[model samples]
Target: MITIYDWFGYELPIKERYQLIKKVGFDGVLLWWSEGFGRNYYRDAPQIVREAGLFIENIHTPVQNQNHLWLDNLDGESLTDCYLQCVADCAEFEIPTMVVHLPSEDNPYNTLGLNRIKRIAEKAEQLGINVAFENLRNLANLAYVLKQVDSLRIGFCYDCGHHYHYYPDDDLLSMYGSRLMALHLHDIGGSYSQHQLPFDGPINWAAAMKKIAEKNYSGATAIEAMNWDYKHLSAEKFLQEAFERAKRLEALRLYNP
Candidate 1:
């Protein structure tokens, strides 16, 4: 079954987070595909998800940073060692992939960053783990980084909300469709707060989900909404929205052609 995954950062407790995911009918989650202000959720996460029979498809972790320590930095060969260790941990728990951010101009156009990521992919490959690269910040423009790396193990995590955030002109869905292995499905404001619900924002769900279906993507689509915690809403209310949107996508898939 094609399942929906969610990103529940440190906002909710780990035990409650798993129960909430099961309650919402999501088979799995993206595991912090977004930023974590503090603490590594993965440090003690897998056992919880497993008890609920929920799987974690991917865990997004920091690779490159500015003014902060970076994993794929140009100055050191050891940057990737840390990243590889994270990957190793993911593999041990049967997490499928580790979503990484591309190093930016902070490290120059040097292939060192790319090489480190490549080596990370190599480590993942040895362990049968997948490596996903996501669009972040201005570089959230992810196509070029994907193209530059051009490795199968290194694929794209299509963050729908991130794309809608700063670049409405770009068709990331088509640009990286073939390489898309995961998605961060959340709505963003046209002129207000991002990560709002589907109907709460100006995003065109029909068009967006249709594009995803067109690609025949076989990956997790996590509902990355904030401020609308699953525990607060009644099941009828939650599924009412989820089922309706899913049905809309189903309709578009068959009728549009």
Candidate 2:
């Protein structure tokens, strides 16, 4: 199925946004499971999107203080609790997967972080949900976590923009493609990690899709594009473009060559 991030740079009401997403021909949406967007609104987002005739592909947990999962402090403990709660929330909402961002930059991997991730994975396994750890700047930390936590419920969420911008030489899909559970497809140009639509930047779409296809990933072809650069376009127009790109991505995945 084709999906896009829910908060794709629109200021409209959540219902309207969801309706527009459905109207533009997307099959599902990836929601941010955080009160940062507003407590009640986000809490009700699953029903809202479902009522609008869209599927909840997954929920991305808040990334704030994610680094605390590594530190041996009260804050780290708090963050672990927060992630466990997020896993429970996925169970409550019936979301099959939860995309997570590990520590930012080059944060060191430690037993503290490994134990917290193990706890979260245990919760996920018990609750029948998948936790997908996204790739960031440091590959070693991610490698360590994935290696140490061998839960079948623990998987990887591949972000195209992040891999291109942060670790271009590393073939992340090859390393963790066997455990791939979700995707954050976007593009980057110039310097920073710009979450632009596919083909809007320098990323090699054919190559990326080829790698994913090699893994036999049959999950939603999801885009996490933001609207920062396309502020001039109307929401409908932006989403229409996104839908087209999503279809293109699917076609690429299906192509043998």
Candidate 3:
């Protein structure tokens, strides 16, 4: 069965986040750095996720850490060292993939991010973790990053919404199915909004997912949504709806297995 890790940022407390995630009906929770999952978060979250019959494990950057990991002209050895540390920490349990983002598109020439990713991939190989590269706002930018980091451990986290933002059509996604490690499933207009739902927005995700399955893209299909109207729908309630949403998507026959 497919699962969604209710994207709970640093806005709410851990206990509150866990409670809501369970109420929402998801069997997984993707925690970010900003969500206060440092030493304390790491220690406490595992138990809670297990208690709820959910898996607790995910990678996210801190607010100070920049959601966009700007891996440009930095000491390669040191950056790699730090990434190795993070991977080891996640290896404690309930972790299988490290979701990451790219740097600025203006200077696409920089290989810093690629080098760091390679280092992390190497480290992950030892820790038994996968490094999932997210498709940024620009496809060209992501393509360049992809061109640089050519490793089996370092794979793509296709953002269906981004494809729609640039342009719609299954053809756009067909080109990268071979590299899919995970998917940041969301919807976009014919423009740039990182997060939205397929039914709520304009991106043709049903088509994109079709290619993902056909290609046998064996990886996590994570719903990387950021927006939340916790007013009418609390995190607990929302999480439940999210699972149903995934069920509907599956019934759509996007993924063959």
Candidate 4:
């Protein structure tokens, strides 16, 4: 199925966003599981999306202060608790997967982070949910955390934009494709992590999709593109373009050999 993120740089009401997503021919949506946008929206988004007939693919946890998971302080401990709550929130909402980032910028991996991730994973396992750790600037930290936390609930969320901008040469799909549970498909060009629609940037979609198919990934073709660069278009027009790009990506993934 094809899915798009709910907040693609739109400031419309939450219900209107989901309706537009459904109206634009998307089968599902990726939600942000945080109150950073708004507390009522966070609490009501799952039902709102479902009412619009779009199944939620996954919910991305808050990224702010994610680096604290590695530090040796109360903040790290607090972060762990926050993640644990996120896992529970997934279960509460019946969302299957929760996407997370290991560290922001260049934070080093540490035992504290691993332990906290383990705690979050344990809760997810008990609640029958998946915790998908996403790739960021720190590849070593992602590698280390996935290796250290050996759980069925623990897996990877591949962000193609981050891959292209941060470590384009690294064959990340070949490395963690087996554990890939979710996707954050977007493009980057001219700047850092622009999150542009596919083909809008210079990323080789043919090559990326080929690698993803080679890994035997068969999950939702989900786009995390934002409207930062395409603000001139109306919301419906933006979603129409996103839906078309997603179909193009799926075609590449299926037809590439």
TM-scores for all candidates: the values are 0.79, 0.97, 0.77, 0.96
Estimate, for each residue in 145-250, the C-alpha lDDT of model 4 and write its tens digit.
8888899999999999989889989999889999999999999973445699999888999999998888888899999999888879999999999999999999
Question: Which scores greater on TM-score, model 1 or model 3?
Answer: 1
The residue ranges of model 4 lying beyond 4 angstroms of the native Cα positions read 38-40, 190-193
Clashes of each: 2, 0, 4, 0
Which residue ranges in model 3 land beyond 4 Å of their true spot? 8-13, 34-43, 62-82, 111-113, 166-172, 189-194, 227-230, 254-257
For lDDT, the strongest prediction is 2
Q: Which ranges of candidate 1 are over 4 A from the true structure?
A: 1-12, 33-36, 63-79, 104-108, 190-192, 228-257
Q: For candidate 2, lDDT tens digit of each residue in 1-257?
A: 89999988878977799999999999999998887756457888999999999999999988877778899889989888988998899999899999888987668888878888988998999999999999978678889888999899999999999899889998999999999999999999733457999999999999999999999999999998988888889999999999999999999998859
**In candidate 2, what residue range of length 10 has the lowest lDDT sum?**
189-198
Ranked candidates (lDDT, high to low): 2, 4, 1, 3
TM-score of 4: 0.96
Backbone steric clashes in candidate 4, count: 0
Maximum-TM-score candidate: 2
Q: Tell me the lDDT of model 1 at 118.
A: 71
Which residue pairs collide in model 3, if any?
A: 24-236, 24-239, 24-240, 25-240
Q: Quote the positional error of residue 10 for candidate 1 in Å.
A: 8.2
Pairs in clash, predicted candidate 1 = 5-222, 136-140
TM-score winner between 2 and 4, please give it. Answer: 2
